[model samples]
Target: MSILDDLRDRGLIQQVTDEEGLEKHLNEDRVALYCGFDPTADSLHIGHLFPALMLKRFQEAGHRPIALVGGGTGMIGDPSGRNEERSLNEENVVKEWSNNIKDQLSKLIDFDDAKNGAVVVNNYDWLSQMSVIDLLRDVGKHFSVNYMLAKESVEARIEHGISFTEFTYMLLQSLDFLRLYQKENCTLQIGGSDQWGNITAGLELIRRSSQEGESAKAFGLTVPLVTKADGQKFGKTASGAIWLDEKKTSPYEFYQFWINTDDRDVIKFLKSFTFLPLEEISELEKSNTEHPEKREAHRKLAEEMTQMVHGKASLDQAVRISQALFNGDVKSLSKDEVALGFKDVPSFDLEESEKPLIDLLVEAKISSSKRQAREDIGNGAIYINDERQTDLQYNLDDKDKIDGAFTIIRRGKKKYFLIRH
Candidate 1:
């Protein structure tokens, strides 16, 4: 199947400037395309996966993909999808973030292929060199104020107020497309739905500036904005945004995010995120319908996503931690796994590890008082490392510790506490 057909099957295509022409262009030769990502933060969030993965998809299809890091445009923040002005970051901070984003993109796109190897470009390299006169006379003159104001990005911000800096963002982005098309032989530009206007503007700039004029084969495509079935935002949990960097969002947390996917959205996510064959996905869809309780599809989604982002070792660790917690076999987990598993659980640091069980319970706030602690112990409601410890006189010892660093305590079936030495 053509790449466009595959993307359509996965529901990735939202808007294409000219579908027939693009398909022809793609089939005629190994087409070059690009997707721009602005470095607005130190880490790229899950929201970035669409375009980044889109680049990967094209690369796997034997096409060249350019991953553009907006080191320059990031300073001027795109007004697309915002109701207010963005606070600008310092140049050094933006540059640092740009580098970090480039590193992350390197993980997603293979840059070593001899034929269709990916390329990472920073707009700052060229955008910084262009003077204001060149920007205005050479590029800005092509876009009129009336045309700019008519765009949804600028139109929406007119009532709330928009600065001149933001008003000219489309022009800057147009410059990026023109520069890349000239330097890299790029013929396609893709982004989220919000970037439709900017993408088209770039196409316009390419066509107008080309010696071939309107016959320049430049095209634009945008993917749909991902939304949750529950109407909540994608890539967000109670903790915060799901970051691509492991330091920001651990592999365990990332695994859990996909594992907990809503039944209504799991198949859609699998189609969009995983490279699983469509036929296999259809079977998974059948399993989802016939045996929703088994959650086979959910597990597959989690496994694929975890392994893709964090590698096999991290995926195994995440699965091991998950299984241990589910089976109430906390002792089987390693020290690092235990730390990752109980990261959010209530924890207490022990000054001494030799206290009586009841005293320790009271000190750790697991029980209201010594009397309650004794009652809990006598009632078989207390456990140490998943083992029932009913003895009222039981003393905290090294045996209770996992790897001699931490102990897992349970007051009842669901409430758990971590004790650190």
Candidate 2:
């Protein structure tokens, strides 16, 4: 199957400009495509996974992918897909974030291209050099205020308020495309569905900037906003984003996130996020129908993606930690391992003065009341660092330390608690 066809079969193509024309363009050898990511956060979250993975796919399909960082546009804050205008970030902050994300992108794409290799560009190099007059007279003339205002990106905020800086974001994005097209012949742009308006603006700028009849029309493609069947956004836990950086999100936390994927969204997620072959995914789906407790589908989904984005070592460690948690083996863990493994478990603090262990247990949310805490201990429902503590008189000691940092507490089989030192 063609790469585009494969993407469609996997439900990656939500919207595209002229499917036949795009197919023709893609059928040609070595098409150059790009997708821009903003430096809104220091680390990329799961939401950025689709576009990054798409870029990798394009490279593997004998195309070049320019993974551009929005060092320029991020500062302006495009209001696309947002309810309100974003808070503008400091230049230094954006630059630092942009650099960090660049390092992260290196993990996924091949940047050392002699031919059809990936490229990373920081848009700041061009945008920073433009004076107000050069911007207004040169690039701004191609875009009409009516056309700009009507775009869903800007128009959606008309009822509220849209800042001029944010409204001009499309122009900045278009300039980046024009610059890329002129410098590198990039012919396709991909992003999330919210970027449809901005993508078209860039395409139009390319058409206008280049000579007519010689007009090199570019294509725009987007993925649907990742969502759950219950109509909530995906890739977020109560703690916030599931980030790509290990420091921001431990491997154990990342594994647990996918292992806990809502049953309603698992198959869809397998299709969307994973690069596994259709036949293989279908086979796993079949197996899941028979024995879901095996969680075969979730396992493959987590394994392939976590390995692709993180590394083989990380995926292995995540699986090992998961097994340790499931087995409730304390001796199998070290101090750092304990920290990374129980990173997401609810944690509480203790003072030296607390007495009876029951009061402390109730305060740590292990039990509803002191009486229940005592009852739980009597019945052997509580554990410290995976060891069952049946005695109500047992108090924490330095010997119980995991890495001299914290203690893992368990209420039942699945629920966990952490007491930090």
Candidate 3:
């Protein structure tokens, strides 16, 4: 199937400027497509994954992909999906973030393919060098004030107020498309649905800037904005946004995020996020319908996402931590696994090497009082490292520590605490 057909089957295509023409363009020759990612933060979040993966999809289909880091436009901030203006970051800070995002994109797109290797470009490289006179005379002349104000991005903020810096963001982005077309021979620009206006505007700039009798063979496509069945936003949990950087969101946490996908959304997500074959996904979908309790689809989704983002070793560690927690076999987990698994659990630091279980429970606030601690122990309600310790006078020693660093304590079935030494 053509790449466009594949994307349509996965529900990835929300809008295309000219569907028939774009499909013909994809089939005619080796097409080079581009997607822009603004470095709004040091690391891209899950929200940025769709476009990044779109670039990967095109690359896998034997097309060249250009990952554009909007170091210049990032400083100006795209007003596409906001009701209020974005705070501008320092130029140096934006430059640093641009590099960081470039590194992350390197992981998602293969840059060593020799024939169709991906390229990363920073828009700041050109946008930074253009003087005001040149910008106004060369590029700015193509856009009119009425045309800029009519765009949804600018129109939405008319009442609330948008700065001149943000108002000209579309022009900057259009300049990116035009520049890429000239330098890289790029013919397509893709982004989220909110970018429909800007994407088409870039097409306009390309067409208008073309030499006499020259046709600008450019197209714009956008993927739909992801939404959850429950009406809550995608990629957000109680903890916060799921970040691509492992330091911001650990592999274990990231795995758990996909593992807990709602039944209604699992199949749709499998289609959207994974490169798994349609046949395999169909079988998984059937399994999901026949035996939802098995959660086979959920596990597969988690495995695919975690491995893709964090690598196989991290995926395995995440699965190990997950299984250990689910089976109440915390002792089987390694020291690092324990730390990751119990990261959100209540924790207390122990200065002493050992302490009586009763006193430890009281001090750690696991139990309200010494009497309650003894009662909990006697009733077999307290556990140390997933092992039942009914002895009232049992003392936690170095042996109780997992890897001589942490002790996992459970007061009952689900409530857990971490003791750090």
Predicted structure with the largest lDDT when compared to the true one: 1
TM-scores for all predictions: 0.97, 0.92, 0.97
lDDT of 1 by residue, 1-421 (tens): 9999999999999999999999999999898899999999999998999889999999999899999999999999899999999999999999999999999998888987675666999999999999999999989889889989999999999999999999999999999999999999999999999999999999989988888789998999999999999999999999899999999999999999999999999999999999999999999999999999999999999999889888999999999999999998888888988998898899999978687899999999999999999999999999999999999999998888898889999988989999998
Q: Cα RMSDs of all predictions?
A: 1.3, 2.5, 1.3
**Lowest summed-lDDT stretch of 10 residues in model 2?**
349-358
Question: Per-residue lDDT for 1-421 in model 2, tens only?
Answer: 8999999888889899879988988897678899999999999998998889899888888899999999999899989988788988999999999999999998888898776567899999999999999999988998999999999999999989998999999999999988988898888999999999999999888888887523576888998888898777778888988999988998778888888887777888898888778888888888888888899998888888788878999888888887887887765777777778777679987655334567768888889998899899999888877888898887777766676777788887878888877
* Cand. 3 TM to true fold: 0.97
Model 1, TM vs. native: 0.97
The predicted structure with the larger lDDT, 1 or 2, is 1
Model 1: how far residue 412 lies from native, Å: 2.5
Off by over 4 Å in 3: 212-214
List, residue by residue over 31-112, the lDDT tens digit for candidate 3: 9899999999999998899999999999999899999999999999899989988998999999999999999999888877
How does candidate 3 score on lDDT? 0.92
* Distance from true location, Cα of 316 in model 3, Å: 1.3
Residue 94 of model 2, lDDT score: 99
State which candidate, 2 or 3, has the greater TM-score.
3
The models' CA-based lDDT, in order, is 0.93, 0.86, 0.92
